[model samples]
Target: MKLSFYLHKNGAKYAMLTSIGGCISILGYLIYILNPLQLILDKLLTFQPGSLIFKLWTQPPYEVLAKIYIFNVTNSEQFLAGKEKLNLTQTGPYVYQEIVHNSEAIFNENGTLTYKPIRELKFRPELSVEDPDKARIIGPNIPLLGISSYMKNEYGLFMNLGFSSVVNMVKSPSLTNLSVTEYLFGYEDPLVELASTYVPSWIDFTKFGILDRLMSIDNGNTITMHLSTNTTSKDDILYQYSVDIFNGSPGLKQWGYREDIPEENSPCNTVEGAFESGVFPRHLKENTTVRLYRKAFCRSTSMIYENTDYTSSGMKYYNYRIDQNFLSTSEENPENKCFCKNSKKCLPKGFGSLDPCYYGIPIAMSQPHYLNADPEIRKQVIGMNPDQEKHDTVMKLSPELGIPIYARLRMQINLNVSPDQIVTSSKPFQGMILPLFWVELGIYDMPSYLGILINIAAQIPTIEMVTSYILGMIGALMIATVGVCVIRGFNQNRSDVESENQGLESSPFLSIPVQPIIRSEFKLLR
Candidate 1:
């Protein structure tokens, strides 16, 4: 009975260990299958044909203005239009609503996808600064187009106008007569539109031919953007609209990831691919440089660098830059008739110099905060903090998810002025790149699915760690208990043997038994 009990006890312990180990094995397998990377890939690849993720990602989200800062510079030593202008800075809030008129998407035979895009724009004149009209016209002269408001209106641009007028203007405003109505309200010339004139005509949203130009490059609407569907190398996808004007091929890969993130063969340009692959060569902490395509200025390559990294809402990101010096040179983009036609000088890095088509009036572009730009850029422009924290065109993203978390696409519109017969007023100005205003498109609060994805990524590792630790501790405790029980059983058996030997040695019968047995044996023999 005792042996049976011992066997049972040992057997029970062995069974318990086996059961615990089995549970751990099952859990580990589950965790691996549900790993964050696999989960994200599953969702993206297995999307039912018209799912929300499909629509949102393929269409992308719209952005709104969070704030606006105008930079005005003055020379105590010089004057324009015979005015000793006071250098000043103006800041305020702006609002607008984007309207998507039509959109469509289709899967392609090349394992790619295409989308057709149609959108419209509207601005809220109310809930804005007063002198809404004068405030609208700030910037350097675009000749027949306009100038920065600071240069246009010597007085102040802020009127702190009430909301009623703005509401009425937008409530029944005629789309056909936008220019006239806005002009009458002193809101006709938006600073962004002024900035757009300086951008290459192909990428200029303000131009009516934007759609045609985009389609002409590849014979597909801007909405028909080609996207890679292969998930193996999430980093290898390139999504920017191609600039195929010179190549005469299907849209040339002009924008988006130009080279591999780590110089690997994997894709790295598509927004989706980057998220899936976590391969942002530009995101390297080592300050690596990358080349990307730009659709606006005749499909050109931009040399940029990962300057730093940041985090928000549990997501990680890297900051990259297209500073003036880096942008001023690119063999990929030859000087074209539309821009750089005159001096054939590469446009200054930050400023857009597509003045050839705009009546020889040079329009320049820069960042809102002018981060990483020429020192002279901020020096001439007041009200600019020039802090990288505020002004950089930052692309905040998650390294793990390879998706953009938040983005601040910022740029300033400036006009280059010089003494010439075309404009006698600019003669006294010398050669100066005068800033008109800067705007930022702040896109944040990622779609719900993306947030879910990030959370899962964060949670999976935690679950694995916690579960492993707890299971490990339990397993260690069980092993220790079994070992102690085994040691105690061995000690108990040894003690039992010793006690039995002592009892046998202390028996009184055994002391006298030897002599008695000898006498009895002799009598029996007789």
Candidate 2:
């Protein structure tokens, strides 16, 4: 009705009407058109992340992707198809990176993912969460992907009273190192594949041709940062192969495909007669919510025009009004301003909710034992990648105070620079999460009750087993002594008056001591 009414009333603005109608068509079908029973069942059974479709939203693996690190390999031969043998001089910045971007109102077709040689690219960035003002991410790999680099440092400072680096401490060296099984390759099997008869009419792609239309419309789909590090620079300037984009992968490309179908479990791999086996619980529904996310990530370069990224680009720091917040137990807003680095910028949190603040430590393959690590341990082992100079220097000066997570991460980044970039973060940020006393009542109660029950239960076993068997050994030696004492007493014919029996002190078998009486206030309980 909305569409028809608008068409008739403002048909004069034919272009706007036509364009909005086109969008409505794509979104309407992506949502109301598809059904996947097998996909739903598999997700529920495995409790895979996708089961959280309402929450996790397609399980885009943003955390892992955010942490991907890149390395550059200098080559003289043609590395990518249709490329040339270009030698990099032994000098300054060299390596390059690639970050992929896509936009299509919904999950895009696979053409974009299938190997495309490097095209236009923004500079690969070398960023530091420890120092947001120092974000240096650009096209390929000149030095950084400051976003991940910063979080890595923040994780490190929160972990060790030790050194961190903007460059070397990067725990994982390649993008492949950061992997998530959010999607199956749309495999076909009879269990997950329903009879063509049961399939719903709305989702029959052959008739609707949504996929064909999606690809044809230019939603400005693109893959950002797909270049190698130009490591051969004037040796004096800088020489390292860090590609912020592809995170070390040279020419490898990624692919995406969607099947317009449904089943009991999942629509992918079949198992135990079910359509598919699993989907991660955290991942969102592909059909219902995937299109909604299209806007969040679609990168409306238009929005970029409206707002300047203070922390990302080179901007004067003091110009924008500074704000803070406390996510921990204190008064929950940023309070008290402190002087920061001379350069201007903001932390992701400071930039407000422009984006979700994502942090991670790359899982290193060199030491595969990291598979079962808890979050804290993982942060310790993974560390950041600012460079040796930065990590070691800041670690020498303890950053925690009166400190917050963002501050600790920032001061650590401050270590790797000319005196000019020295800065500190004033915002109240959190570090590795720990239980706050008042907030975690549940954690305390369960253990105390279990201990009480276990204590009472242990008494039965203790008396039944130890009173005899263990007592036999201890009683044997004591019996002999008692007998000798009795004989001695008889020889004496008289005994001295018995000493006073201390209540609990005299009773050995089951004496219960008086426990400390807590004050009335402290004794309060739920």
Candidate 3:
């Protein structure tokens, strides 16, 4: 109303000025109230595919544990060997000796007249010695692609087509500075893609006891170290595996129990083959450490399933990133609900959540310290599985230390439907996305494309009322000033009329009217 009045009174100029003032004040007040310090925290929150915010939230006190094992793990490749040579011996006049046959000599240095390849050398990968990425040093007997024989025979280049590197173990007691990953098998850029990047050296020999003894290696135990950074979050589901390794191959042998995590399955921590013990040699008893830190950060309010087909969901989906703390509690009773609960690991009551991906004993990412191949002893140890069929599980499984955590577990959330999606806590998602994408972008990470909807729901229009009111107040004050001037003018005019009337009625300056007064008085008296 005041604004309208001002326009009529020619006070419209104040509107924009007052509005700008109001906006400034509003902006300041809103920022002051947010208190951003309260909202930021550190948790293991992964980037869920379908959400921009509110992702899988884990419980508090998830303890991260490390089991240090001292063992020697050797692969199929030989570091250094005696040379094969041709020699002549004297007996009678001309001692009978083996003829010059190149193919006959395989390993020994003393032969008849033929010198074979000296010794059939095991495969090794070519690698970059200079450390580029600041990561934990790698160890020996780890799995990786070896230099191919064809490439070595052709261009005289090392057989490794970027599939090897030297694991630098200066401080670590594992292997020496040997080449492990040089380049990807067929990759153009080694830095960007993960498939091009080779696995660490410790993945080669993953068994314990006779497994290493039978292969002629000293020790060949395998254990995975889960990091506190991201082991217990709502986003990632951790698992372990055993594999088979080629005796003469460069990297660690394949899984000694299972190749990889199984397809559409759960964790198998209770199972025996999931882990091994004493894989290292008796001569070297120092433990090797591998560390896996958090890499990608993302979040959402919803929990993403490893198996569910989220491509068709019509709901507004979510993804998020949140900094979380460790949440590990002791669950000693195997019969209770929290029986499987413990620090550094967990296995809930509902097991089906890990569909499309196998869940098993947790595995560890390689530490930078344990990298490098040693020039010391013996043979390589491989996985023991004789089955011809391949497994569908992809998660790695191991069972040495920490908790061999295989059991039924519950989902982060609980849902019921034709195909139900459940959520237990929102703690998994905080800080996963931006306000604009959650409220303005209108697109969800999920296929449903409902991010914009959530953004709109959280939005509010900027009101101009404060500015308008301020402008109206100023205009009204100006009009009041004009009214005061008009009222003063009327009072002045009335005062002047009153003064003129007093003069007219004052009898013409009675003193100067002496003669007229005498005449007037006489006429009155007569």
Candidate 4:
């Protein structure tokens, strides 16, 4: 009885231990399979109110520097006399800190948000090569040139003659020496005042500042973006927080695309699916192409993958550059034909017309020093030295988060001078695309705190993997312990049975005895 009781008690104990081990193993496996780490990460990366990413998007922590380099005309006399090609000398890198803020953000129910961007520029003298107010540049008369170019196309002969008379009365020089500050911010010119007075509809502002007009923010302009938080699908997550609309429209009316036009017909004017320079999508791949939209540019520009690289802190980044065919003529890149504004004649292979967006001013944009421009266009200028290192537009982005680690966005502003026989001052600049200035705007490096956050975000996958492995190991160990318990229980039960049988065989009273006189006893009974 005692032996039987001991065997039952030990068997029950083993069974209880096996149940506990099985439960622990199952718990460990469930933890690993559920992947709670990923859930936490997704929540952190989502762009919503009170989220880290949203805060960063609203106000970036790093500084964006604008370095302006103006091109000074050195041989204006000789060039005007038709004796020399337009000779230019590159001038100072007047630095400014550009502060951006997304104001009055409103979150919508359809997984989108809208906000107005307010940007301010502050001069950083310490970072500049020289004082802009004191630095002088002998450059083309922008007011005279821009007006002459506009009138040549829009005004009749009588209007052109009147404009020519006004120009002669004001004695506007074909080229003028002015402080860099005046050239960039604003300058007092009688021609500009007269134009504003006469044609307020076209030239409302009496002062014309290239950078000032470019950076001016319209209060009514707002940007709507996809939050990318509604779905957990990988593909959907790849395009997180991309632009959805600009100024309440996906395509610009200025670029000949109205609300009625299909997006496929006017792809160049489509602003949707592009990202602002401050933020990009997550999980960027090598083959992925990115488009950046800026109000100043009036269109989105494409950036293609160039190579893979590492930041100074050992974080991985993917390098991208402005598409080489971004400004190419239709002959070179047919897709850019829409930029010609329905005209069969497009600008030369290098220039992009900005007149549609720049108040009828015949301003064109190109890469700094006309890098990769047509040989003919470069031949027209004497001082153009297109160095890839200094002139090319480049952006280094984190592959995982699509964050811009370092970027240099370079662009040169040029005036398209179409000479008018009626306007004699413009005849000197006949058939010329004059480079006025170029700007390099970007951040040099990420702040240390931002780098730390990026590193942590990058390590999330590894952390999740390690955690899963640990949980799996724990589960395996618990399962193995359960197996050991089962084996030991079976062996103990068998040994107990054997010992009980031996006891029965060795017992005095409980044993069975064999009879020797069985045959004789059987016969007597019969």
**Per-residue C-alpha lDDT of model 3 across residues 1-526, encoded as one tens digit per residue:** 4333434554344445445555555544543454222222111111122222212111111111111111222321232121221111111111111111112212222210111211111221122223322212222211111111112222332423232232121111112222112210111222212322343332222222111111222112222321212334332222221111112221221111233533312221212112121111111111212112110000001111122111132222122111111111124322222223221223222111111111111212111111111111001112111111121111111111121111111111111011110111111211111000000001112222223332222221122334444555555555555566456655766777788788887865654857888999999999
CA lDDT, candidate 1, residue 80 = 47
The 0-to-1 C-alpha lDDT of every candidate, in the order given, reads 0.44, 0.22, 0.22, 0.80
- Judged by lDDT, which candidate is best? 4
Tell how far residue 264 is off in model 1, in angstroms.
24
Per-residue lDDT of candidate 2, residues 249-330 (tens digit): 2211111111232222221111111100011112111121100011111111100011212223221111111111211111
Q: Candidates ranked by TM-score, best first?
A: 4, 1, 3, 2
In model 1, the number of clashes is 30
Instruction: Give the lDDT of residue 13 in candidate 2.
Output: 58
Candidate 3, residue 89: how far the Cα is off, in Å: 53
Estimate, for each residue in 1-526, the C-alpha lDDT of model 4 and write its tens digit. 5445555766667566656656656655665677566677568767789997788878887789999999988888888888988899998799999888888999998878899888888999998999898888899999889888888877788888888999999999898888888889888888889878988987778887778778863334788988764465556654567787888887777777777748445568787777873677777778678888887776779999988887666678888999999989877888787788743347898898888888877888999999988878888788899999999989888876668988899989999887544677778887888899999998875678778867776776677667666755665675577577666767777888899899988998755454646876898999
Candidate 2 yields a Cα-based lDDT of: 0.22
What lDDT, from 0 to 1, does candidate 1 have?
0.44
Flag the better candidate by TM-score, 3 or 4: 4
Backbone collisions counted per model: 30, 93, 125, 0
TM value for model 3? 0.24
Residue 272, candidate 3: alpha-carbon lDDT: 19
Off by over 4 Å in 1: 9-17, 29-91, 97-102, 117-315, 329-350, 355-362, 368-390, 416-419, 422-434, 444-452, 472-505, 516-526
In model 4, which runs have C-alpha deviations exceeding 4 angstroms?
A: 1-28, 217-220, 229-240, 308-314, 342-344, 478-526
